[model samples]
Target chain A: MQTPSATLVSRFAMEVASACFVMAIGALVCFGAREFGIGWGDAGPQPGYFPFYVGLIIVIASCGVLVQALLQRRDRRESFLTREQGGRILAFFGPMLGFVVLSVLLGMYVALTIYLCSVMVVQGGYRFHKAAAISVATAVISYVVFEVWFLVPLLKGPLEAWLGVH
Target chain B: MENFGNLMDGFGIALSFYHLALMAAGVLLGILVGVLPGLGAPNGVSLLLPLTFTMDPVSAIILLTSMYWGALFGGSTTSILFNIPGEPSSVATTFDGYPMAQQGKATQALTLAFMSAGTGALFGVVLITALSTWVAQFALKFSSPEYFAVYLLTFASFIGMGSASPFKAVVSMMLGFACAAVGMDGVSGNVRLTFGFTALISGISFLVAVIGLFGIGELLQTMEEGLRFEGLHARINIRDVFHAIYTLPKYWVTLLRSALIGCWMGITPGGPTAASFMSYGLAKRFARNKENFGKGDPNGVIAPETADHSAGTCAILPMLALGVPGSATAAVMMGGLMIWGLTPGPMLFIERPDFVWSLIASMYLGNVMAVVLVLATVPFFAAILRIPFSIIGPMIVVVCFIGAYTIAGSTLDLWLVLPFGILGYVFKKLDYPIAPMVLAMVLGDKAEDAFRQSMIFSKGSLGIFWTNSMLVASIMTIAMLLLFWPLIGKLIGRLRRAI
Candidate 1:
């Protein structure tokens, strides 16, 4: 059993790690942009220039945050995440992540249909027929409204491309 | 007279069927978003921004601004009836609002909140109408140095005064500013930190970060705790509505004071939460029946409600006059303005008087509509509370994703929303103030741009900050105040001990 203070210290550690992760990502992006001949310009600046500095700032500030998190007393810390709280986080996001991954493979319409149906049936406890009907109806309607009427292009996935529907 | 004529011209544009429909839809959606816990005005507006891509700029702005006003009003509804605050600003309302509901005066409390919100919104609209020109003229004198000073002052005041820990607040603010700097060097055109991902080209969307931090974050926390129902129900009646208005005159001073506080706070970056808290504190300090404050006192309801709405309404002024958003909601509206290709700033008034005036006019109209619509539909909204969290929770998640996807029409944005949501949850759990982070994110770019511009103009001499008398004084004052905050707090603590 983890004590509350220990849990808090761990949480702070997690925060520091997350910040570092973000900073690292930012640094990598800046370095890549630099390689693309996107340095600061003579006539003011280029597009990637400001971003490089921003990434540096993130790295520096995140380091400071990490240091502070490390130096902070355990008793003064607080746990923002716990195992018990993970259910709510996962329940909704789990389906969302699945939806994204599925969209890439199955295409927008089919992916949405499957995702919605699954959400309604599994999480919503709706009957199979009811979930399927609702999902299909919603997808069809959205396709008509956004794709046909609004002329907003919805991404067709790799599966659709194989079908010559690009 | 010219102002009145301009306002009339504004009404000409605003009264059109298209604009009216936009306002109504915006307000309705705003209310829905505000009533939903973990979803606030900024997120709502940001989510809906992509929809306005097809709309004319004027209609788009009117719609977004109306949504903002509507959300502020709607937030109070949840606070009063369910003891759940939809937004941080509505937290103060929960103090007396819940008590009133418990006392079987839920209808009365709801009505009073709505009416006071409307009244305060009207006051805010009037101030914007009257003072926008003057404010814009004054803002024109603000160069990059002054703008930078103003940004710094706003950041300091928001953190130092608002947060529980000034040091942590400052750190949080700097972190946000750092995040804002991640994509590009605005001045030198040098690439700063993009490690190499093509996504880094566009930089992080402030909207995405805010949505993730507050929206997804809260969703994560809600998942952890599991949804708990307190089992509250209330019936609103026509007589209760009348009673709410009759009860208003008794707290006239509180209303005026709160409205004033709301207006000033909204114009600056103090925002609705600060306004609500400040108004409640002032009301408590000066109320004749201070003992009754926390115990379902009507004055208690009036104070925060009025200020919250007024602040919400007046926040538009800064966005319109100076292109500065005082709150997250205002930031969304600014984005809307930008989408419309109508830049918000002093030039807005000169170039787009019709857009400016009409938005102001619609505030007056929207307030009346909100009051009538909310009063009539209290029972309906209350009925929504009966729906189980399980159902509402998943639906909210779907909407969150949809909203995120709508903004940039990118999968990366959708993915980004979740982390921010988790971040929001962490912030809430840790009792860190999320408002500072959101505000910092919004102002971060502007601050950077102003700093760099000022540097270029002054040939790298920091002394240019003091070259302009007004800028010099403001920066000095802000610096002195920030430096002395700890000392002031200690002195106050000692005084309290002595007392």
Candidate 2:
């Protein structure tokens, strides 16, 4: 019934969800802390003792937030995000995910070239030649800065080995 | 007088041509980073941190601190020209600054901001010079209990003074402590919370978290908002600059009050952002022409810029004296200190006086250079803003990922950036304070160590916190009061109403 730009999720839902997620993480922290013995020993408190209390506090605080959110649910109907905003975030985040994956596969320089060019062409409405030129230039500059000057080796793939560059 | 003599020696150490060049380069890069969206002082310093690994500690700190000053100055530029705050601390500057620019007083507004900012920073550095030795001497007598109390007070003050919900702040802070606890325990020689994952055994790097949160997270936010920089064209005229300088004396009251507020907040961990807002609020409240605020009032621009820069400059003092960072940026810099094998506490003054003094000396020189360099470079940075976000956005993303990879050369760390980025975005939207979390991540283990040591000293009795030396007791009392101040204020209001 609403357009794509309409509210996708209300603030109350997001608040309750985030608080629950935090509560779950707190539970996990507490569970993990118990493995190391959350107790005071001869040398004083055990390794997990401090974390145990920290996790307990997190849980309690999260519960407080959750309760607050629930109590104000009737009046707090502001949207956390519109559908259009979610799409924009996804569009931005998707390429980032691809860049990371491609970096692991094709090395950062190659991945950088591909990712930059594609994002520019697909999302930015740039001509292919212009995007390629810019992306390639960026890759070369980063290569010089990171590899040649700084001497910090990056994660390289088979292509770099074939090209006989470190 | 001894401190003064040492400061002179510090000037000698910091006056080298090489250090001065580094200062210039650092400031230029800082301005670029600050002017750009999705990059800020914390992430910018972290990105440069790996480069400093090879440099000496004093020079490295000088470079980073100069960059900090430049970033503080740069943040205000965007606020005036574009109404977009390049830094969180400069958000208050946009209130009056943009309106003044729209009224065609761009040059005057900018000069006022830069002049007041420079004056504020000078006051902060002077305060540091005068108080450093005394604070260091006082802190030298502190034991584990006292140290624990200080850390407790730092965390409690965030809850007490932050505009965020108290419970949300607690959750964010506790999450940081939990993350900090995920590594091998130094005291017990026992691995913790790693869940049998080899990657987490070394624990979560705050650097990675910072990259994700401040860098990538910010980019995501910018994307969602579809931010466009439609800014006024500003070119500083020499006449306007001098005229503004001539009129600067008229605002001496505003300047002095703001500087004091800035110093108080910076020393007590309220940070530059809060200090600016607080200063702006107080200025507006006391001003006879309160209606002129948020319009084209020069005092509105002067107050926040003065408070922001002064708070930023004074925040470094606590990091030097007490190992507690007064802001998130200082927290990142302190993390860098640890990386450089330097322990940041009172003993740093005794053990590494040269390093400390040189750093102090550079703060003075850096602010002077920042003011001069920022004025000349405003047009250049404004032009940079003309670059479409499409190109710059992805470029920043690449830079951020590369920075993360360089931190430890681990693929896992790069992978970790994604989740933390989401966490940063969600938390920010929900008003969960990130600075407290970052501070906790930086100091969590140390605070825990101090607490444990105090417990061992007292056989696990909490009374030692209250019954120990007057210093420890007073600190604990103050922390407890701050933590419960909201509740007490409410109770007092009810009592007064009943009467």
Give one digit per residue, the lDDT tens place, for model 1 in B1-499: 7788888988888899988888888888888888887678878787777777897777877888778777887888888888888878999999999998998998889888888888888899999888999988888887888888877777767655675555445545655665666666565455445555677666777778877776777666656666654636767778878977897888789899999999989887778999999999999999888889889998889999899988888888888898878887787667567656777788888897877888888888888887887777667777776766655665566556665666676787767776677667665665556776766676777877887677677766678787757655767577658645866888999999999
lDDT of each: 0.75, 0.93
Q: Candidate 2 docking: what grade?
A: high
Model 2: CA > 4 A from native: A1-4
- Interface RMSD for each predicted structure: 4.2, 0.8
Error of 1 at B416 (Å): 2.0
- Per-model TM-score versus the true fold: 0.88, 0.98
What does the lDDT read for residue B276 in candidate 2? 99
Chain A vs. true chain A, TM-score per model, equals 0.74, 0.94
Off by over 4 Å in 1: A1-79, A148-151, A158-166, B182-192, B483-499
True contacts kept of 2: 0.82
Find the candidate with the highest TM-score and give its number. Answer: 2
- Report RMSD for candidate 2: 1.5
Model 1 residue B235 CA deviation in Å = 2.6
